[model samples]
Target: MGDFVKEILVKPIQYADEVVKLADGAISFRQDCLEVKTKSEKLVSLLRQAARASGDLYERPTRRIIDDTEQVLDKALTLVLKCRANGIARIFTIIPAGAFRKITQQLENSIGDVSWLLRVSTPADDRDDEYLGLPPIAANEPILCLIWEQIAILCSGTIEDRTDAAASLVSLARDNDRYGKLIIEEGGVGPLLRLAKEGRMEGQESAARAIGLLGRDPDSVEQIVNAGVCQVFAKILKEGHMKVQVVVAWAVSELAAHHRKCQDHFAQSNVIQLLVSHLAFETIQEHSKYAIPTKHAMSIHSVVMANNQKNDMDVTDANYRNNEQDDECKSKIQRPRGCQRIVKCTIW
Candidate 1:
């Protein structure tokens, strides 16, 4: 069967499909290829070879490589997982940090969307466009779609929409409980840190979110901190957009959740101020509800760390308690609540 596949099925794709017999033969070969055992060394070699071959056709039929890549990835991922079924997780334990770093560089270069790129990396950093090529203006949606497709292969068929793949990676980073088993402690961190520094606000936000997730794992957190992810997040907190602000705030909170020292670092970086300011102006219900208060808590934590300033900052006040009550009343009355509590009534 392997010989039949190599001879009758695989060999014919190389020739012109002018005759009806050739097209039929190619179809039969594709079917045979699909039926090949996931553990077959031949299939693995074929996939790797096909990927390399796609490179030679780089200038022409770039789309063919893209299409073939999709097929190859789909098949290879199944094989890789099957190979890992037994103590495969142990393989990553021996894999060096530098090895994961190299793979991550190649992965980022192959991505096709800049906005999607930003979500996956740092918003302020420049991308390696020379390797990825200028993002096709007409291909934004399609590239984003393909990026998600690749991510889905990594995720266990749980992700259907590609848009969620980047977010899923971020989520993986934040809560090692979800994907820490499949992904190495260092597997997702390097690309995330690099993204945390480059591209656009959306990309950086995504990377920051992942960094935050990665920090939840004890092993991952130490490496990310050692790699200076916190410093990058602090920079974004000061200069990024609302979405970027929210993710960075969450990432910092996750880092602080694991280590008290992170609070002190954030304080020294003046990130506490930015978090406070963002909480002050945030209006989106989700942002105001989760992010703003969480950031405020982190800020107050920073204050505590900086001065032992156990100033009894009311948790309710920190929760935007006054504004929320007013909103609740206004919604019930169907009218804007006017200024009603301006009298000087000190809580003495």
Candidate 2:
């Protein structure tokens, strides 16, 4: 834990402290900057607690959470510094209020992650209790607690429960880009991806769609892709319920269009080729009113493929029967089966 903490978490903690100082030091955008500062301060405290945790601190997922937290802090610092600039520097900075809001959302997610880690880590933070309660939510982002609740349901709930949770997640994510990124930062990708693979049809579709919407930034994209999104998508496209395939198809397209690098990922995953094979039999036309978008287009492709195979078999059987009939005709003629047969042929 000691070596891993120094290597993986120390730098991120430093970055968080830097964000705190920079946000506090910034003169302009004070209120917005302070929002970031307060969040960073909380993150630092949480991170320190996480560092002392006795569990497998070096695990890949743990490292990822800490690493991602570091990234948000770095972003916060960059934004705060830009806000700190004055005169010509300030002119070039062009800081926006929404930028701080987005960073804050990410930071709160980091705080939540560390808090969760503290609860699960061995010997627990409290030494007496095996589980620690979740940290309180920010007053400004009260919806965050609800978002976290749905994600929790997605993790361990039944099929119908996960499906409903997925729909709730999709709705919150669709409300704004910030909320989408927030879901990503809160470790929603793992369970969402799991549900996409194993849940009921309704759950799979919602889970797949939510994943696409979650790619609100490069960092989130990295998290989603690294969570095996491309592989999962490729598998589904090749052999999932046709309706689920359509949802995944739309998901892949949305992420690719949102990021050029994501397009490269699909090609690497061979999903692009899979999509082409699908398109050969399916039309591009789509309608939105169905339970799954593009349901009609894909349904036709399945029907067409089935019909084509049946037609080919039918033609082969017909040719075989015709050859048999010709053989019978020749045999009868050769055997001189009846004088009436010969007479009929001559008359014709």
What candidate 1 gets wrong by more than 4 Å, as runs, is 1-163, 170-178, 181-186, 199-204, 264-348
TM-score of each: 0.35, 0.46
Give lDDT tens digits, candidate 2, residues 195-238.
99898889999999899788777777778898999998888878
Tell me the whole-model lDDT of each prediction, alpha carbons only.
0.43, 0.71
lDDT of 1 by residue, 1-348 (tens): 223223332322322111212222232223332323222333234433433433222111234333443443343333323333335453443333343234233223233322232222221123332233334332533433333332422322222222244566756534546464233332445545555565466666666766666665555566767777757776776676656766676677776677756666667777766666554443332232333233444665344433322222343354475665655443532111110110001000
Q: After the best TM-score superposition of candidate 1, give how far the Cα of residue 46 lies from its true spot, in angstroms.
A: 3.5
Model 2 bad stretches (over 4 Å): 1-140, 283-348
TM-score of 1: 0.35
